[model samples]
Target: MNHTKRSGTPVKRSLKVALVYLLVGGLWILFSDAAVERVVSDPEMLTRLQTWKGWAFVAFTGGVLYLVMLRQFQNDRVMLDRQLGQQEEIRRLSQFQQSVIDNANIWINVLDPDGRVLIWNRAAEEISGYSSDAVTGSDTVWEKLYPDPDYRAWVLERVSRIMAGDEEAEGLETTIATGHNGNRTIAWNSRSFLDAAGRTAGSIAIGMDVTEPRAAESTLKARERQLRTIMDNLPGMAYRCLYDEYWTMKFISSGCRDLTGYEPDELIDNRHLPWVDLMFADESDAVSSAVDDAIAAAEPFSVEYRLRRANGDIIWVWERGRAVEDDGGMVLEGIILDVTERKQLESRLSEMATLDPLTGQFNRRETDRILQEEVTRAERYGRKLAILWVDLDHFKDVNDSRGHAVGDEVLRSISLRLADSIRTVDTLGRFGGEEFIVVLPEMSVDEAWDVAERLRVRVADEPIRVSDGDPLTLTISIGVAVYPDHAESAEGLCNMADKAMYQAKDQGRNRTMVFSQVAGTIESDKSGEA
Candidate 1:
């Protein structure tokens, strides 16, 4: 619009100037010629006036031309200033875009159709350790970045496929060598486009180094494999479980077989078997409560309990574990080792401490303890307990003549018979040479007397066959004492029973006597006063 309007201005100015000149010149010519003719008598004088009119016309035309050219120059100057302002705006906008790309952390590359660099941003220069002048037009720069020819060919082939093929490389990962760093892993995003003339413009790729992250991923994979191997080789199952009533197993190691006679498949995620079912029925509540308490306190624990295996066999085990509760998502993780052998050994050691090696009965220490306990129980319940002090008749002669081995054989036989004659709750133990004590829990003196008589008959009627000699008949004299009836204390009662046994010996060889028969105080000597 402005160009069209300006183009018409020169014609308008010419028309106005032409009109003015025509008007003024017509008047001047008409009047001036008349005046010249009137005032001059000679024709030469009239010609001079006409000449002056001609000079005036020339001067007036020159002045009009100067004003018109000045106006045109002013209009041209305004147009030029507007054009300059627009060009400055466009230049600033282009600089702003370039600055943004240069400061971006990622490397940017722009190439021509021949793969020669057309643009390499600041990041590219900083990372590649080369200035833009060095890389922008160098065809050999691509080779320096990726040294191997075959690798370059492969990359070019791939880039070609991406540019021309139906499927393009949206986000491609590749490796490149840095001038100083040797090698760098990169993730690239590239695209091929058309130029202004609609020809292929090669590709532009934006890349980021991923060397550290890739190395971390590789290390993680290796660590995971190593942990899995350790889990597989464990002697017992390593488990992660939910803090549920069943202590549901979420994950279990392959060593589940060695500990529970079950496969990992049977326990993991509680598929077919729950961990709670493995505990002994009587111990389940105690064990669960204990673990819950530990978790509540955020403490670690070690407890011993019985667990039942798949084959219905029960074994003892020691379990140590910790509870990790974060954000209230409770998870239980720990190892369960097969400590059955250790438990068995402990049980054997306990038995050895309390049982006699020779007669397989309660030894002296255990018998005394049991006697004291039974007495306390009897007193508490207002009931009676019977303790029998028994002696063998003529066992010394057998030991002296035959051998101590024969005496041992006789004693073992007597112990067997006594054991058979007593109640299940009774305890029998050898007190000393030819002396055995039997403790009957919850038995009255009358009941104890019957038990004593049964034992006496069983022993006397039974004969022991010596290894080298003929069979020897044995008779036992028993003295019975009732708890809190004969004497209130174990020591006093035992003394009374001892006196009763000696009385039986004094009366005859084989007999049964009750402590009430000699209710008086009995001395340490068989039957003397204190």
Candidate 2:
């Protein structure tokens, strides 16, 4: 609209000037000629006056022409000055725009409709390692950047589609071969522009290098895979979880299935059940307390407790964990190992150390230790204590006749009978070959004799059965000794009881004898077998 107004103003001003000139010239001619004809009468005087009028007319017309020319020249000069100023401003604006494009950090390039390079900015030159003088006004830069014919074709096809308005130009990425630097990956955004006639002219593209970022991403992924592999191969379950009552799991390793009989997904975030739910009800509180204490102290924690597996079997587990700071809050990271086998082995080892393997009764060493402890307690409390030393009658005859295997069966049977005959407070142990000792606390001499008789009767009342032979009748000779009555110490009592047992065996087999300390001489009360 402004262009139309500007063009129309020049035409209107020209028309006004032409009409003024015509009107002035027509008025001057009509008025001057009519006045000359009316004022002049004589022929000679009229000719002279006409000549003077002609000269004045000539001068008047010349003056009018001169004024018109001077006004036109002034108008032309003003227009020319305004036009020159506008042209200078346009040149400065173009220079500024070019400076911005050339100095921009991002790669900017323009291509003609025929795919020839039209404008290549300084950034493009720096990124591509190709100068503007080398790339501009030619399409050969495309080949230099993309050496592979097929790849270049694909890139050109995409660009063509963008120019045709069939595909969006934003975020179109491509790899290019730089002139000096190695191949680099780039991300591109492009658009097509139109000329004054609204026809497709050329396209401009902006690119960003993404080579370093892509390399870093790839390295991170590889490291993640390595970490995952290590976790999966571990012998126990490894986990990271929030330090809460539920122990909300953030990550659980693949070993979860083998350790807990549950998949990792099943336990993560308490999807199926919380980790605390797997702990034994009685031990969970102690375990929680230990962890809390360790966390408060900013130290690592280790606890051994029982866990109820998915199949309802209880197993011992050892766990080691530490509190770690995370973005959200404090969390726990740890590993759990099944220690059930180790616990069972330890129990068996303890039994092996204290009990006789054949009969499962206290061995000599453990029996002696218990006797000493009972003696010490009785001495401290001034309570009476008694001990019975019993031996099988003619046990060597059984071993010689029935072989050692049958002898072992007989020994085992007799040991069970002796164990069942004694009170729970009494301790029954194998003192030696075919010999047993029973320690009784808070028992007097009479009570010790009674217990010794009962033990003898219990063994003699039944014929011990063997696995591969007929049952054989057996009997035991018993000896009784009381603390502070016959002996003051455990060793003294054992010696006294042993002497009484040999005396019973000497008198006759299968009888009981009680040792006495009257006048520092040994005495006995003999009881025949039942």
Q: For candidate 1, write residues 159-198 as lDDT tens digits.
A: 7765663345655777888887778888888888887998
Tell me how many residue pairs clash in candidate 2. 0
Model 1, clash count?
0
lDDT per model vs. reference: 0.81, 0.88
10 residues in a row with least lDDT, candidate 1: 521-530
Alpha-carbon deviation at 286 in model 1, angstroms: 0.4
lDDT tens digits, residue span 1-530, model 2: 99999889979988998898788778877887778778987778878877887788789878977998898999999999999999999998778658887888888888888888888888788889999999788988889999999999999898897776567677777899999899988989898888999987988888888889878988999999998998989888899999888878899999888888988899998999999899877888898899999999999999999888889888888999999999969999999989999999998998899899888899999999999999999999999999999999989999999999999998899999999988999999998799999999999988888888878877888888788779999989988899988888999999999988887887786888888676644455556534
Report the lDDT of model 2 for residue 250. Answer: 91
Top model by TM-score, which number? 2
TM-score of each: 0.73, 0.78
In order, what is each prediction's RMSD in angstroms? 9.3, 5.4
The TM-score between candidate 1 and the true structure equals 0.73
